[model samples]
Target: MASVSRVASRILVPFLVVLGALLWLVLGAVAWAMQPPTTEQLATYLDDASLAARAAEARSYGNHLMRPELLERARFKAENLSRQNQGLAPLDPEVYTPPAAWRGMPTTGTVKVLAVCIAFADKAPVTPVETIRSKLYGAGTGSGFPYESLSAYYERASYGKLHIEGEVLGWYTTSNARSAVTETTAGREELIEEALDHYDALGHDFSQYDNNGDGRIDYILVYWTGEHGAWASFWWGYQTSFWATSYSVDGKRLGDYSWQWELYSWPSGSYTPLVAIHETGHALGLPDYYDYDGNTGPDGGVGGLDMMDANKGDHNAFSKFVLDWLTPAVLSRGRRAVSLAPSGEQPEALILFPQADGQPFGEYFLVQNRWRVQNDTPLPTDGLTVWHVDAQTDGWDYLFDNSYAGHKLLRLMEADGLEEIEAGGGADAGDYYRAGSRFGPDTAPASSGYDGAASGVRIDDISLDTVATTIGFRAEAGPGGLPTAALGLLLDE
Candidate 1:
């Protein structure tokens, strides 16, 4: 009887242990299945952290003029004047495409800028001159928290192809009071001319500032002290009066110039370089990504996810490509699989055309891997960011009052298919594509043309890893597959 009892106990103990283990596994699987999806988790995190709110605050203080269309038209006229001054034939009004240099400042090589610090007679300067200098040209090893200077931002955005080397000289008092200069366009113009004359009297050779010898200086940045005045007093970039009237100093013509407050008080209490970096983008010929309609329109533009939009993060891949700093791999037809390094880290990106023979500058899509690193640290999330671009449309069409009346020149193709951004939502974690996600004709925002025709372009199996994001592409059948031999086509000369 004792031996039988012991054997039964041993058998029952082992069976009970095995049953407990199986029960735990089943409960674990059920709990996992009931939990929210990864996207939901990401959205919750972004909300709890107030990432979107921070972006909104950064955007509240507008960076450019309310009427950017007028600026572009003025720029066109100025470019023609610069060409004629350089003894080059003026760009034909009918020609949409011209030499890259004719677009704006030189896209390649070192660009020498003249930065002048101005103080209003009424308001005192806030940031010191040396601090502004460090913010502009300092290597990442500085006292400032960002450590990334304005020059560093451009160096990274341009993939080292373009360098910003310049001098920051100022604290030069404006003769007029803050209210006087901020009152009108003519007043601001007089202030700029006053500062240039001050430096010119000091024997500063203005001719050396013209880096490209195109009869114009590369750029000039005026850092002014005090709170911005009215909407008219907001920061902006424009060609100096000479751009229209052939204005010159010391035999050098004034070209593109941007004026910004010496410091911004949002997100950071101290002076930061983001606003300066953004205004410089305008100097580089890139337009603002924010909606001019004040979110009253269907879309709020890019929703502050881009540097040119909310003055946050690094420049988007499309901006770099426009400046001739990035060359994307073109996929026009058939099926292909490729991996893209983080665009902020590498100059690599992918371009897809709806039609096999579509022009590179025409309607197309740009895909890039955006990771939250370096200057992109402010971004809410990281994944594959897609942009819908129609270079055929004038950039001024992005303005609300402009009569161009079509799709925006550039639009962020949100992965969540919510069009929340178009509904005036700020950028959130759901805006990007992650692993297992697919974008094609079958998706909510179908890969279609503005005319509502199905575009054969399809992006599938987007997978993100620590190294890079890999994606597969498929195009509708065409006469023949694009030449695989010329896979590396430069977008611009």
Candidate 2:
């Protein structure tokens, strides 16, 4: 009787195992069937032929921001990392070297500005002390040009964390002709000497301008007395500096070096505060966003979307984030919903479609809300703004004949073709969103998507209210989504 019972138990146990396996298979099949068809359709659209082609194009030019040698070294390191993970030995860095760009990085955030007002032959005479206080320092006057306005701009742009500590140090009369203001080293030195002498005579210690007593001035704002014409104002500071001032570091006087500074003519009645704002961006490691051609057009890739691109425009989220103005709430792959308050108030932006290819720097799509407020004087329109970001070490915009010396870090996402950009137009129709605009990777033609990509970030659904001006948009990861962790490294700040 015991032998018979053991035989039945073994047979029943095997039968129960088979039934459980069958039930699991049936449930899995039903769950797969219940998924929305749109999910499958979206997955298909993400991989559509057009999107694949555009992504290839975007990829080819994605490294335009890195110097050739730098990119190659990055590639080698990545390969070595992969090999190590596979239990292989790492490569020697002494044999494979990175470029100078990698060795030395640019400075960003909380730039200290020392401003001087120079009177040249009384034509653009020394700006009135009151006027300088108002316009340059944002001090003491209702109608005065508020330096605070510019400070507020930076503070708001940086989400109230970063801003400039600036003041009009002193006023001086320089007898030199305005044309003598060459951007050359000797010329700038001469002007600086004269301004320093003037301060010395007044018994004002220029050292007070050094807020941190760092022995080196982070930035200098030389406001020459007069406007020569349209071309008189510009930013000219060597990417690297050897010159130093007589300021003491520890016990010795290691002169202050002029690494980054801007020389601009005093703002005539016609000038807007943005001129100072735009040039200061240069001191903080930003490049000109407009086309650099001697002739004019909407030739810049960023066009009017950024302050670096045009005068008095809202800054793009990429620029703001890089400068440590704001940090984005990391977006995950697949589908998700996003609600953006005005960038000035909430300073929130969404990132999507990170680069997946082995390229060192992957492309990123940024979405933020832009509206008119304090310092963003004249935006094209109040709506959502998108940006497609890629960086080039020796990048030249299609508009330039020669490569620019420093980093070219961004590109604007347009809603239409070149027609959407106008030379002096702030932000325009095709470059931004409005109340009824449908946003998606493929919804708008390539003419209207980021970098003219027909398919990339699928904007899926969007709803905007004019009165409230709150923007609610949905975006999903398209094909070739890079590891979210990799993007986080690129934007560690």
Candidate 3:
């Protein structure tokens, strides 16, 4: 009886163990079946993988703009750097201070420009006073170019909020014998002083055009009557303007005072009058978008896409938005689709790319629909133009210049197909987004897409419908993540 009982116990124990194992397996299957894969989960994975791949690519190119480690370091500097004695204009209570010191705060209104056309050469022919004045005010039209074009460019760029008004103080005969090439930085400054003196000699009050009521001229546009080049345009580095003390038609100190002065210029047909517009951008605190060294770093210095970089310049959406000329339609979280009108068309719409995580300015991206127009005639094709702007990287900041890809304020999205075929070596068609192309984290691995995700803005299905004369796109947060408007509003305060 004992043996039979033992046999039964062993068999029962084995059976019970197998039954428990089966039950456990059944429960596992049920759990697995109950929970299906989620869209959020898939998106998260994709975002991660995409970001990882982008990180590797950025590492290969030393792209500090996108690298996580570099970004953290930048954040630390922005927070810890002392603003005291920085010479920065006092921050307005309402102005938004971005994480990067470069962006600072945008201060825009009517740009008051004082035009001084100087005859740099003794033989330099006198360009008509009306011609100079008209060019400045967009009066007469010719190949020499209309000065008003510069103002119109700003006016249209700002949507009329920031108009560039100026008076050509006529042609001032400079006593400086230096040609455009021979003029030293110091000499050019002295020439500027001499030119101002010439204006004074004519008995024109320099104080009349002080539009800002700041007791100083906001900007100076000097058109020297000779071949103009790099030397022709620049912001005077020193704060002490000779004009502050007294004005001398020749060159002498008249008073003991100090003031800040910024100037830009153009040659008389050395390049288009549009060159003035480019230099004027500098006066507005924008930097060159082109690779100054001429090395095509990463994307070819935004490659003839922006006015700051090329002659057939267009006021990129990002630049306009930064200058407070145009406000972008902020695309927020959970927002999917946005319909946009052509920049040339009515009901003009500009879309601001979502901000990056922990970034003060989030490498701002502004989108504007582009088609051939009077000012933007150089567009290779009709399509949507996406502008990548970094306000955190100052025009003067050289440390991050190579890392930031030339420290250009306005970088273009060179997704346009024609860059390779049509525009040729001289032109840049890369930054334009044509119909059916998508740009975002997923597309970053491929060179075909714009590096939009690098700036924390992902764009997709950017299409242009010629029939409707409208452009459409879907924007979402990129890998780095974007701040909510509510959150940003609070932070801004």
TM-score of each: 0.73, 0.62, 0.60
Per-residue lDDT of model 3, residues 282-302, tens digit only = 555444443322222333345
Q: Write the per-residue lDDT of candidate 2 for residues 55-119, one digit (tens) a residue.
A: 23322322213223434443454445334323457778776664443321122344456666666
Q: For candidate 2, what is the TM-score?
A: 0.62
* Candidate 1 segments exceeding 4 Å error: 1-103, 140-147, 179-182, 234-246, 264-269, 294-298, 356-360, 393-404, 467-484, 488-493
Against the reference, the lDDT scores of all candidates come to 0.59, 0.46, 0.44
lDDT winner between candidates 1 and 3: 1
At residue 369, what lDDT does model 3 achieve?
A: 76
Which model is ahead, 1 or 3, in terms of TM-score?
1
Model 3 segments more than 4 A misplaced? 1-111, 142-148, 174-183, 226-272, 295-299, 344-357, 388-410, 416-431, 444-458, 479-493
Worst 10 residues of 3 by lDDT: 26-35
lDDT of 1 by residue, 1-493 (tens): 5554454333223222322222322111111100111233224434454323332433443332222432343335434433432345767775544443454566678877778888878877877777777778666336433325888888877889888878877889976677776545556667777888888899888887788676777688877777643222244322232334445788866766776666533122466665567667767766666553332333455765776655667888867765667766666555666677778778888777544344323566778888876666656777888887755525543332110224566678888899866655566678787776677878877777667877677777666676543333332322232433345332221
- List candidate 2 segments past 4 Å from native: 1-111, 121-126, 139-148, 175-184, 208-214, 227-272, 294-298, 356-360, 392-409, 417-419, 422-427, 439-455, 466-468, 479-493
| True-structure lDDT of candidate 3 | 0.44
lDDT order of candidates, top first: 1, 2, 3
